[model samples]
Target: MANQQVNRDFLFRRLHSLLGVVPITLFLFIHLTMNAFATKGADAFNAKAQTLESMPFLPVIEWVFIFLPLLYHGIYGMYVAYTSGYNGSKYSWGRNVMFTLQRVSGVVTFIFILYHLWTAKVLPDGPSFDMVQQILSNPLQYAFMIIGTVCAVFHLANGLWGFLIHWGVTVGPRAQRVSAYVLMLLFVVLSGVGVSALVAFHG
Candidate 1:
């Protein structure tokens, strides 16, 4: 029984990690790319928005592909963060940072997502260019959005390393170390794109 429970938990953790990557992280990239359209101008951004928002069955897609996976990943991630043996002091500097940051950013991302969705999706303005611009124009809101973007992006990028490891794809210290550096670069690039999009909207 004890062994079964442990096995279940181990499998759950992998699913939780996997969800963070596939639709969750992939959606992030698409979101950032769409937002990046703002850099070109409002017409470009709004047109792209229209294209996406007009997609048939977008609501279902959002719920099934994006929101469902995110909901599970965030909830399970919070559970694991609280219950796992993730002692920062037990591991080396790399593991220590990964463990601590994973928990911290997971919490931040969870809290931030509600505010983000409320502002970005639930507003009276909908997904229009003016809607995003109006919200980001507020300096405090701008800061919060930037911070939230960092947390969300970092959580995914960092967790991506764990996902590869969990799947036995990147086994061994040398591989993980190399992957960490690569993912760190990915995090920075994604964060830059997200922040830049916000900045464009702010203008």
Candidate 2:
């Protein structure tokens, strides 16, 4: 019985990690790339938004492929974060900081996602360049967005390194050290894209 419980927990955690990288992180990449069209100008951004809006079974797609997975990952991740300890006798300071930030950012990202869905996605008028521009134009709102975007991107990128280790993809100090650098670079790149897209709203 005890063994069974342990196995169940192990599987649950594995699923949580898998969902983070898959539909959740992948969706972030695609969503940010779409947003990047804003940098091209209003017309370009509007066209991209139109393309998305015109997709078939949009509600079904968002609920099944995006929201459900994200909801599970976020809720379960919060539980794990609450239960897990953040101390170690044999880890670098950078690694320790990442572990702590991972939990902190997870909570922040969940809140940000809720606010974002309400403000940008579920409103009556639908989303457009002008709508997003108006939304981001407020200085306080702009700062909040910048923080949310950075936290979300960092959560996704850093969660990826943990995903790899949990899945036994990076099995040793040497491999983890290398992957840490690579994933931090990934975090920077994704954050740049996210922040740039947000700022593009003002242009």
Candidate 3:
């Protein structure tokens, strides 16, 4: 019975990790890419946003593919963070620090997402170039966005690295190291894109 319980727990953890990489990560990439249109102009951004809003059953797609997975992953992650002890101080290793950051950022990103959804989606006005520009007009709001972007990007990129390791995809030391560099590059690019979109709104 104990063994069976352990197996179930392991399976749940694996699923949580897998979900981060699949629809969750894929959606983030798509979202950032779509928002990147803002850099071109408001018309470009609005057109992209309209394209998304025009999708049939958009709410259903969001709930199934994005929101549900995010909720599960965030809740489970918070549980893990609360239950787990931080050993980064003792280990003083990069991965150890990253593990700690992963937990911290997960919580921050979760809150950011909730607030963002409320402001952008829940309101009857809906998200638009003007709406985004207005929200980002406040300096504090701009700062919060920059911070949120960093947290979300780090969470996804580092989560990807953890996902690969946990799944035994890159177990060897050399392979793991290479994967680390690639993931770091991915983080930089994603952050750059996200921040640029936000900046475009600011200007």
Candidate 4:
């Protein structure tokens, strides 16, 4: 009875930890899709920007919904990763490589996100469509954005793969191998689309 109780408690904790990733992933997809609108020209991109800015209490809402939750999710994710003993070296070679890539990409994404928010959301001058268009017009900014998009997509895909394993969907060795390859392919394609969109952006 004691052992059973301990097992149940462990499972509960894990469930709580794993469940938080779902909403974060959902938001990531939404963000990526929205950003891809940059490919459609300034008018289209600015329309979306105007819509977001036009929301009532926009600043407060952004703090509550975008910044706060993102900070919490990132901290919590790192905690779970550490406590779960998620050492990539113990996994298959492909999984290990993906794991390392995801972590490195996550750091890059974090830096990119901070810069993006600074330039596009939180600056004292307020975000301007003209300013954004000018930034996008730069080759360096385009390169940074392309790298960030690829990193973000791969990180999300790898996280989903890890989620499957956590949920017991990819249990045996063969299934794990297959899922890893499939997710890698999926992320590569998704990243390609995202990079192309960013590269195509014009004022």
Candidate 5:
């Protein structure tokens, strides 16, 4: 009975840990796709953004759906990494590289997201489509945006790889080896599409 209880508790904890990733991953995919619309024109991007904002109880929904999930996922992911004896140097080269990339990119994405929200979503006198055009027209904004997009893509891909492992799909030596290359390739393609969209918007 004790052993069964322990197993149940362990399973619950793992599920709780995983719950953090799901909503955030979904939101990231949707957000990346929507932001891609910016490539078309300011009007297109604004229309999408405004439509989202105009939804009933949008402010409340944003807090529930976006902010809360992100906070939990980011914080819980870091906690899991810390507790799981995750050592970058001990893993295979590809695994180590991806692990490091994910950590660094996660931090970068968090910072960029915070800044984006502050400037684009929260501020009282924040910029409009014209202002965004002017800002993004600057070389600095362009560079920062490119870096942020790359970081976001890498983070998402890396998280997906980790999720697979957690769900028992990629176990042991051979599976880990294969997953690394696959995830890396996927990240490259995803980031390429994202960056292209941003560039097209600016052009």
Candidate 6:
């Protein structure tokens, strides 16, 4: 029974790590790229939005490729976070702090994604550049966007490194250290693009 439970835990952890890197991360990349179009001008953003909207079975694609996987990954991640203990205080290591921050960011990013989708996708106004600008006109909404973007970027970036470690892709300390730095650079670039697009709304 103990062996079975251990195997089950291992399986779930593997699934959680795999899902985070695959469809979930891919969706985030596409999403941030689309939002970065805002930096090109609202017309460009609107054009890209309309083009995406015009895709056949796009809602089905979203449900199958984005929403369902994201929901599973998020829920399982929350469970893992709940089960894990935060030892950053005791360990006082950079990786220990990042481990705690990754879980914290996961929770925040999950909530942010839910509210973001509800407002931008499920609302009667639909998802348009003008709609986003109008919604972001309020200072509170703007602040939320910034917080959400940063949390998401951090979560995904750090999660990428964790995924590699969990999957045994990066075992040695040197490999892990190099990957960590690369992923941090990735987070900065991704967040910079996202924040630039967010600020473009002020125009």
lDDT of each: 0.88, 0.90, 0.91, 0.70, 0.72, 0.90
- Candidate 4 runs further than 4 Å off: 1-20, 56-61, 76-92, 124-129
Q: Give the poorly placed runs of model 3, Cα more than 4 Å off.
A: none
Q: In candidate 5, what are the lDDT values of residues 43-108, reduced to their tens digit? A: 887788777666899768778888977776566555544565446766767667667777778778
Error of 5 at 125 (Å): 6.2
Q: For model 2, what is the error of residue 51's alpha carbon versus the real structure, in angstroms, after optimal superposition?
A: 0.6
Tens-digit per-residue lDDT, 50-75, candidate 3 = 89989999889999999999999989
lDDT of 5: 0.72
| Residue 4 CA displacement from its true place in model 3, Å | 3.7
The candidate that achieves the highest lDDT relative to the unseen native structure: 3
lDDT comparing candidate 1 with the true structure: 0.88
Between which residue pairs do clashes occur in model 5? Answer: none
The parts of candidate 5 lying over 4 Å away from their true place are: 1-20, 77-92, 124-128, 172-178
Predicted candidate 2 versus true structure: per-residue lDDT over 41-101, tens digit per residue: 9999999999998999999999988999999998998898899787744665878978888
Candidate 1's TM-score reads: 0.92
Candidate with top TM-score is 3
**Model 5 weakest lDDT span, ten residues long:** 124-133
Candidate 4 lDDT: 0.70
Instruction: Give the per-residue lDDT digits (tens) of candidate 4, residues 119-177.
Output: 66667355444676667788888678778878878877887787788789999989987
Alpha-carbon RMSD to native, per candidate: 1.9, 2.0, 1.2, 4.4, 3.9, 1.4
The lDDT of model 6 is 0.90
Rank candidates by lDDT, best first: 3, 2, 6, 1, 5, 4
> How many clashes does each candidate structure show, in the order listed?
0, 0, 0, 0, 0, 0
Candidate 1 lDDT over 116-184, as tens digits, reads: 887787865658779888887888989999999999999988988888888899999899999999999
Candidate 4: 10-residue stretch with minimal lDDT? 77-86
Which 10 residues in a row give candidate 3 its minimum summed lDDT? 118-127
